[model samples]
Target chain A: MEGTNFQRYLARKKAMSAYTWNEVKKHKMLYLFLFPFLLIFATFTLAPVGISLGLSFTYFNVLEPPRWIGFTNYLNLFLSDDIFIIALRNTIILATITGPVGFMAAFLFAWFINELPRFIRAFVTLVFYAPTIAGSAYLVWLLIFSGDSMGHLNAYLMRAGIINSPILWLTNPDYMMYVIIIVVLWMSLGAGFLAFIAGLSTIDEALYEAGLVDGVRNRWQELWFITLPNMQGMLLFGAVMAITSSFAVGEVTQNLAGFPSTDYEVHTIVNHLVDYGAMRFEMGYASAIATILFISMIYAKRIVSSFIGKIGR
Target chain B: MIGAAKKDKTSASGRRIVKVSRAVRKPNRSLGGDIFIWGILIIFGIFFIFPLVFNINQAFKPLNEIFIFPPNLFVINPTTDNISDLFIIMSRSWVTFTRYIFNTVFITFVGTAGHLFVASLGAFAVSKYDFPGSKFFFGIIITALMFNQYVTAIPNFLILTQLGWIDTYWAVIIPAFGMPLGFFLMKQFMDTIPVSLVEAAKIDGASEWLIYWRIVLPLVKPALLTVMVFAVQALWNNPQSLVIHTEQLKTLPLAISQIIGSPHAPQVARAGVNAAGLMVLMMVPIIIFVTAQSNILKTMASSGIKE
Candidate 1:
């Protein structure tokens, strides 16, 4: 029995090696086609990630040799960095506000479109979605909050006698987070809205018919039992997108709030890392922050996926 | 079916009577829904268009008029003075306003074209070829999609620096070629194509290249256009990457930033510049989107892909 088992093991190894070689030979052309892309992707995407992971454990300042520090950067970031904490807080705030609002807005817009006559629905969707292509959503907000007497929002406020003095909306730290959140909602509304619209379009019309037959009356009932359940995948997808976007909240903050808000109130984890990682060249510390952010995103993703799976099932 | 038809007919006549009575009682309700839709649409339209309109208005207005009380919605005398001044400030030897435009156009075109080629080929491989590691390749693509650029900015910068690629168009165009989102969208669309066609092509002894070019390429036009729209928008709106390599090469967003950050940066007129820059940057994408709007939406809706 022992001799036969050894022979079986040897036979299995030979078969596996042959299978591997056969796969290599059969797909040789495909590999050739994929070579350039794989090369570039490795250099650009995979290699950087691997390097960053390594650098997270080392103390490197771009100019000096990378010294092996072994989790010191991570420890220091958690223990001593006040800015990182502030960044984490701000990012959470922005994400928390933007995610739900944006998701709801998109879902509603999509549902509204889906309910409309087919041709008109397409036209309205195109128009509603045009702002996304226009790339001036943030610019519109800038016009509204120009921080001066001639600014549109301030001008309207003054005319209405709401306030005697123009409010420094962008400059003031108190309102900066709100301003960023509003802009993010505006910009993100288009994409997520479109996603939800797409998701709504996929809900088997038969499901709605079934709901109607079962006496699922009114918008709320239809939404809870029919729409929401059918759109589970999309909701999960949108949530992941929102979370990732929240983590990477740099552009609106940088553009509208400007760098280092009054007391760093508007700074996010991304902004902090960008300042240190790119500007100041603190490679080790920046990598640590990035790794933490990445891990959090993965955790969020798992939770979202599980939630989607439960709903889908 | 007959009972439902009878019920529909009864409901229609009953609704007609109610509609007549209701119209008599509340005339406005007849137009109320239409009015409400139009009102909402107009308000949102204005909200959407105001920045571009305001900026265009500001760009043409005299610098003094830019800050006029109750800021002019309509510029009385639209002039090129600000634009000419902008040109003068932006011009340095061969690098002029026209040069900036040229640089932006060139980068956008090259970047979009590169993305189309590489992403399509990669997508075709992943979708059609039952090769070993195809799944692994696709997994990598999806993983890359989730890997936020913000997190990878440091490592990407380090790699670029090591390669001495900073300040070069390659720094922008090369990396953008393998857009994972574009690849994924294309793959999803390509998956719907009948595999029998590819097999038939193989039976004819056609090379993989010919099969892709002749069969897969034509079949995936809509997806290609979708990818094009995405690529153009991404490259055009990318401001951060431009910041990394800021020396000789300047894209539209970066150019606008330079104007904003310049010594003569008009405090109030900055709003106008912001608007004008965004408007100009947005024009190309809007035009492309309008031309391919139907195909784009159909592909998006049917394929269930999002950026």
Candidate 2:
């Protein structure tokens, strides 16, 4: 009986391999098309994450060969590196504030502007999108939040008797994160915003009429019942964009708050990673930091995705 | 038979309940609601456009106007001096100003084209055909969008070092071709194209490559254009700080920021020049976007992330 079962298993395995090979031959052209992207993606993106994860378990500083030090880098990160905790806390705080708020703002703004005339719609889209695409637009913010009276916000506030002196907005720990959040929110209406706009437009108009017949009383109800359900896919996409942007909040903080801002107030995991990886050349430690960030981002995505699944149900 | 009977009974009751509760609800565009929405939009619009307007105005402003105490939002005595000064500053750099422009243009063109071609081909195969690992490949692509460059930068650097691609334009361009978002989006858009259309071409003895290149591509022009906008925006704005180190190979944004003396430096004298440089940096991508705006919207209409 055992010999017969073993023979059956071998036959099944052989059949599966034959089936797969036939499929491969049948779709040979498809594989040919997919080869370039797969090669590049595996080499650049997939292998890097795997390599980074492996490197996180070691102690390497680039000049010397990586020495195995399993869990030491991670242990040091959790216990000894006080800055990592602050960075973790700050990243979570930043992501929490900006992610959902930015997502909602993008969706609401896109929906609102969708009802406008075509020309006006395009113009409004440009207005919302310009700050993000503008490579050095952060310079405008630097001037606006400049530490002196010459700064626009300070000048206005002082003239209005709101404050007596310039607030040193960027460098001040109390206000730095807030400034970063505001800038983040400003630029958040990006590709996701455009996607929402397109998604909103694509909803079949006939559905609204059908919805009215089914007792959808007002625009709000119509939206909840029809629009939300129809655009859940776009919402999911937008949520991913929002989560990624909000979590990877590094450059804005650095650009505005002058790298390693006062008290490490606005220090994020990415900033810490850069400090170790680029500045300090602690590749192992930086890889651990990156691993932590990657895990948290995936966690956030999973939560958001499941939550989106329940929308308008 | 029993299950069918039960389903009928429940559906009948459901219909009755819906009918009983149904009201004569007008699809009304209330005046108050319109005003409220428009009011909010106008406020947000101002918030959005304020910086761009300020940047543009500052670029055209004379040195005196740039330093005005209140920082006038509008320029009274606009001059080409700031723009000319930006040119002068660029010319004085170790690398010629045109070299920077050429570098950016070359990188942007090659990167955008490579990404679009590679991503579209991958997207087409995955979307149109039922290959063994197609679903798994696409699943990875979706998950890939969850992290940004910060998480991948170090490992990417290591990989580039291994390939001996560091300090070359290939360092920037090749990696960009692997950006999964474009693949994800193009697949979403491609999925909307009917399979019958491809099969029809196939029945006529058209090769898969010919069908994809000649027929499938033209049909997905909006997606093509949308992806182009995204690719252009990314490559055009890329500072390429991680890989490329040669001054001659550096792009426009790096050069502009260098000339403008880092935003951290409180140089009052360089304010107008900074604005002019920023204006130049910001406008190219925006112009490209404006031209492709309609097509992008059409493409994105089909860009829903399906489970």
lDDT of 2 by residue, B50-155 (tens): 9889889999998888887887888998899999999998899888889998999899889989999999999999998898999998989888987588888888
The parts of candidate 1 lying over 4 Å away from their true place are A1-17, A119-123, A135-137, A198-237, B1-53, B72-94, B240-248, B262-274, B302-307
lDDT of 1 by residue, B2-65 (tens): 3233434444555564346653532112233434445565576565556555666766777677
Q: On residues A220-287, what C-alpha lDDT tens digit does candidate 1 reach at each position?
A: 45667777876664576566666666667786787677777778889988888888886888889888
Each model's DockQ score: 0.32, 0.44
User: Which TM-score value belongs to model 2?
Assistant: 0.93
Q: How do the residues A110-186 of candidate 2 rate in per-residue lDDT, one tens digit apiece?
A: 98787666668888888888887876676688878888887899999999999998998988887988898998888
TM-score of each: 0.85, 0.93
